[model samples]
Target: MGRTFIAQRGQTKSTNDRQFRRDRQTPEVRYSIENAVEIFIHAKEAEGLRKSTIKGYHDTVRYFRDWLSHDIGYIDEITSTLIRNYINYLKNDRLPYQGDEQREKTKKGLSVFTINIRLRNLKAIFRFLVDEGIINKNPTGNIPLVKDDEHEEVQGLADAEIDMILGSYDDKQFAQWRDKTLVLLLLDTGLRINEAMSLTVDNVGFQQNTLIVPSEIAKNRKHREIPISREISKRLRQLVDETEQYFGEGSRIFMNAYGDDFTADAFRKRLNRLKKKLDIPKLHPHMLRHTFARNYILNGGDVFTLQKILDHADIQTTRKYIQMDSEHLRQQHNKFSPVRRLFNRKGKRL
Candidate 1:
């Protein structure tokens, strides 16, 4: 069959639009750093980037301006030297809350990892400016990211601690069911709290035994499905039944008493109350995720599979679970090494 030329209008329109853009692409005026920051952020927002990401750009720009004492000029003035000084300043900046109410006591400065984050933000901004012809050189191209080892080891709940927390919930009542389901879902699926909380009744496919994470709620903006156990499916169905009865079929699975969708603040508040009631120190949403990852690693789940389960963009992020597993290996080696049998305490030549 020959090509059915249904409508060449879209192609013709796009060609004309590209030609117009090229004709009007000459931006000869140099934008002030402050003005360019807003332009770049607005551009990002226009491109449908996440609000959290755009907010980060705003925060970094505001911080960078404050660091400059509001004397920053045109975008062209941004140099490798200025960025280096900003990095040094970030290295030396301390927080008042790392201590007590004395206000005079300040703890050590931000960690290398945090400093690297700010530097990365700067890199993104300057790179954007360079692309737009608002700046001549990429001021951040030469600055190196901070080493990961500069931060403390990633922490997670132990297996016994997981048991303690899970056991703490009675699950006899509705509230208990909701709380336990929240915790366990995070553990089982490694779903971010926001992603889990965003679930509507329809998102939980009970028949298929899968929890569908829509792109809008997903961090990576890619839709994915999580396989659910029969028990989870049953609990989800029960929760859906109760929630729909209260707030109709359009109800969120994790709504508050007021029928409002659960927010991170609400989760934290509930977790804090639970912590105080149970007297457990370290219980939070992300720890449940870490626990999930650790458990997955120890139970012979590989990094690639865990990465897909966690919806991570890069496998390097998933590789941290290997380190957690290695820690367990070190403990096991110390406990049951057969080589220990040949060693004597008073070893001259046993």
Candidate 2:
């Protein structure tokens, strides 16, 4: 199963070859970035990475393939200079991965965070190629990552803010009913926006007080039931009852104004309108998810349970949802400080 790969520039066969078994016997395997990507992506699928993760690989590597002229350049043609050139392209040429009309950065090129995402993804693909003996060196070597500013983004809304948003919606109105249910479902269950929107009427178990997130729609590609609040369960049943009256019993739980199932883009636009109407500076499904995690931890739920509730593939991902800024820390201290618990007067013990 050995093949002769082209050598790196100015290097001998024995110099950087990890998989070269050819001593003038095996046929040389011509390797291009395009070929490597196709090979590697299949390997990724075989390795059981999530579909979304594989999609990210495809998205990021397409930029690399484009830069290298997929048909002409072999993997050995990748040099540090080519990688640097692509990094500059990401910074100066590509549109931001996620942006709004409000963000000025979207008008031109990507933000540092978005560029770093592509670079990190490139580094991963290069590492894979090197391990498989397709490339001798990782051209993405030692390139600095753009400093990401995710910490500065507000992680979760204040409890009072969440209350204000939820309470402002009047469920008698059809639009309010849908938005309120969407917000409450996200807050109570920690479901991702897509997962919640993809739910069919049968996916909800009114008697069991749970929502089934199917593996096909879940980010992790696994089926799990998210327990709903009694209030949410009641609201969900009511929505289903109303929708069933028109679309018959088995329609999607959340739908558009016209009572059709939601597409991802439609759901997002709906959330955008909800955010503006609520007067919340920022409101999105993930923020409600973070709010769920924060409140879960604050109210004595453990990280392991939070991990399962959030449907995170890793506990580390769940950990990011717990926001403990100075003000929050101070508030927690006022409630649970051991010194305050034991002392009655000044420094005197109770």
Candidate 3:
């Protein structure tokens, strides 16, 4: 049976007859604990989160639910102290997948980014609880989120690195064709991994040379079209032909050789394998999307265009991609630097 939240009841004691017999109710049926998680999951789906994102939300909250059920009891008892303790538990605990060698290895905790994800999910859950009248106020309202220093360093990928990653893909290998296509789609369209994978044959307009990604498929459930580059178009046509040949007409543009839909875990594994072979660290699918925006901005693309391409709901959200490279910074310094061309190698005065 699927997990259900039963309101828990605390143990009770009652005095009986002249013998003074005490009646005790078992602790199991205390209060009717409404699994606050159901509300959170339903809310995200109602808002049209992508299938992958919905799954992610479900997983995060499911773990949280389990923790609350077993390690801690009573939803009302969830407090800031409990949340902090839960964070520490997640940080210190060894994952089930840890091998013998890794078992003894002093593994580090979740990165600030990952920690923030758990925090965000919990916060969303509490917000939903409040909206549903499960709780009068959010306990996580004032809790400070873990600050991520890595985000400052990982502004975006560099232009040269982008070229290297794309160039690393072997065009002639059929086995890696779909894999390469995934990278191409992310780089060219700036689509999230889930959005790119959800695309069916008809979603692409060969005549218009555009791909129509609908709202429900996107991260934020916003529809947008991204133009395909000439090179990407050629590869997509080949991939489309192969997909039709293998899976019949109107099939997905990319699929596993076994004709199954690509899973998120599989994609992560693929990228990790490729990263190991290429000697790169943290080569994630999002990095390709970031690479796209970074290179686009480097080559004269502006925030407006980037926002549309990246499908960001706000222009400010897109502005983060406008990070200038070292060369751009140097050029700006040479053009309008306060020091006026420091040494004046060309004898051009300010």
lDDT of 2 by residue, 1-350 (tens): 44556757875555324433443323257686678888889999999888788999998877667666555577777788888887787777766543455644545567787788888888888888878877767888778787755556448888778788878888788867788888888888888888888898778888889888898888777898888988899988888888777667668887666768866677567667867887778876778888888888988999998899788888988888898667788999999888877774566755
For model 2, state the Cα shift of residue 47 in Å. Answer: 5.4
Lowest lDDT block of 10, candidate 1? 1-10
lDDT of 1 by residue, 101-174 (tens): 75534655677766777778888888888788776678889888866554444667776677777788877776
Model 1 lDDT on a 0 to 1 scale: 0.78
TM per candidate comes to 0.78, 0.77, 0.74
> Against the true structure, what is every candidate's RMSD?
10.4, 6.8, 10.2
Please give the distance, in angstroms, between residue 27's alpha carbon in candidate 2 and its true position after superposition.
Answer: 7.2
TM-score attained by model 1: 0.78
By descending TM-score, how would the candidates be arranged? Answer: 1, 2, 3
Name model 3 segments beyond 4 Å from true: 1-31, 34-36, 39-57, 65-72, 91-105, 148-150, 153-168, 324-350
